[model samples]
Target: MANIEQSASAFLQSRRSVPAKMLGLPVPDRAALMPLLTAGLRVPDHGKLEPWRLLVLEKAAMTRLAALAVTRAGELGLDAEKAVKGSAQFETGNLAVVVISSPKPSDKIPLSEQVYSAGAVCLSLLNAALAAGWGANWLSGWPSHDREFLARGLGLHDTETVAGIIHIGTAQNSPPDRPRPDVAARVEWVSA
Candidate 1:
């Protein structure tokens, strides 16, 4: 790697969310996106059970998702504004990948582990996009949590839940860095 990090902390500190709206045109093609997806799949899996699956939503699919959100919101008797907001991410995205937490049957491997693996995949996808010189954001809205929306809109099974919608595109502007968490306040020194 040409720009290799000298430290682990530096590697993590470099990661940040680039506003999806600030992203420009010309998203990654299928061939380019495949490697990113593959990289995301390489996450921690207890018992070697890959519990996460992704749905790559392009421009056309985004329109469908937005349309579905509008219709489903009416069915659920939610506010029009909320409905529109929920779908806006999809409608405006250059490209998106839906990380689904597909918890499968496993008596030994805990369900929590499966859910975590899915979350890990979400982070992996987001980081991969940033590393590839693309702006990416992991997001979720009311539609993701709503049962009708997932079923009627995204066609997600009951066993599957949407973890996040990973938006990817070329960054239009430089992102302003935000405040970091107070690590000292959050940490506790454990001495035996």
Candidate 2:
């Protein structure tokens, strides 16, 4: 087999999240986005229950969501500055994938596990976009948590919730590296 480990390790080591605000167009066309979506579906799925769904928000959809954010913000009694910040992402982005965690009814698999699977899907989608030379950021602002926004904006069911909103587009500028967690301090070796 080819030496895939080296390339994978290098890619993981160099990977960084580009902020959504720093991302610009042209967003990946369906042809390019398909492979990323395929990769996202390849994550660890216990019981083979894909407890997640992706909603691609293009220009018009984003605009509608942005408008909803503004109205919802007012209804939620948020201040102007915070409301603007909440909707700014939708107002600007060319494309974004909203990962919805939709847990399925199961006896063998617990709901927590299903939730984790959804989270894994989010990370996988983000990484897939990054690996494909697109700037990707996983974000969830106040609007994502607002029930009114969820219902009116995205039509998310009560059992379903936003796992992440992954913005993917061309990067406006390269960001400087931020500090990483000290793994040694946080890790513990145990043998029993």
Candidate 3:
């Protein structure tokens, strides 16, 4: 049917990313973001662990978070430029969703599988925002990788980590599309 074809095209065309700097907002509110987040929660879960969570960042918390980034970077001796860039995401973002990788302890489900599911959640969130006609970017800067930053800003538990930060907003500019990987190189045909 035409609908199936259209859906396929939309999925393919959706593989684009705009610069985080080029993003400004009118960020989606809780009421507005509910649908977008619900869509993301639909990602593939191997063991139904739902091993990820989202942290919504509103405009009010942006300044405090940015300042925390500055302080955490100093403590960690991270590059100043990188720290500033990391902070800028929160500083400028009108709203954001931090994808927290929270793996449930499971005997049957390996930890790696849960991690993969968290990663899938990130992609799903990114695409959902794009499909909804919002300018969205998924970022995980140095701060995300820093334990100090995670503790101070996100209060990430030992079982959890930052998978990605999905920044949603109105677009300041339409970014150019980058090239995609060749499918043939990345896939293999196996007849069972």
List lDDT for all candidates, in order. 0.88, 0.92, 0.86
Residue-wise C-alpha lDDT for candidate 2, range 78-186, written one tens digit per residue: 9999999999999998899999999999999999999898889889999999999999999999999988799889999999999999999999999678999898999
- Candidate 1 lDDT, tens digit per residue, 1-192? 445645435657878888877876889999989989999999999998888889998899888988888888888888979988987887888799999999989999999999999999999989888888788889999989998888877789999999998999988889888999999999999998
Task: Work out the TM-score per prediction.
Answer: 0.93, 0.97, 0.92
Model 3 C-alpha lDDT per residue in residues 1-192, reported as the tens digit of each score: 999899968775765766777888577878989999999999888878789998898887777899998888787787989789978988988888999999998999998989888898888888888888888888998888888778878889877899999988888998888878898999999999
Ranking by TM-score: 2, 1, 3
Model 1 residue runs over 4 Å out of place are 1-9
Which runs in model 2 stand beyond 4 Å of their true positions?
none
Whole-model lDDT, candidate 1?
A: 0.88
Model 2 per-residue lDDT at 167? 95
User: Compared to the true structure, candidate 2 yields what TM-score?
Assistant: 0.97
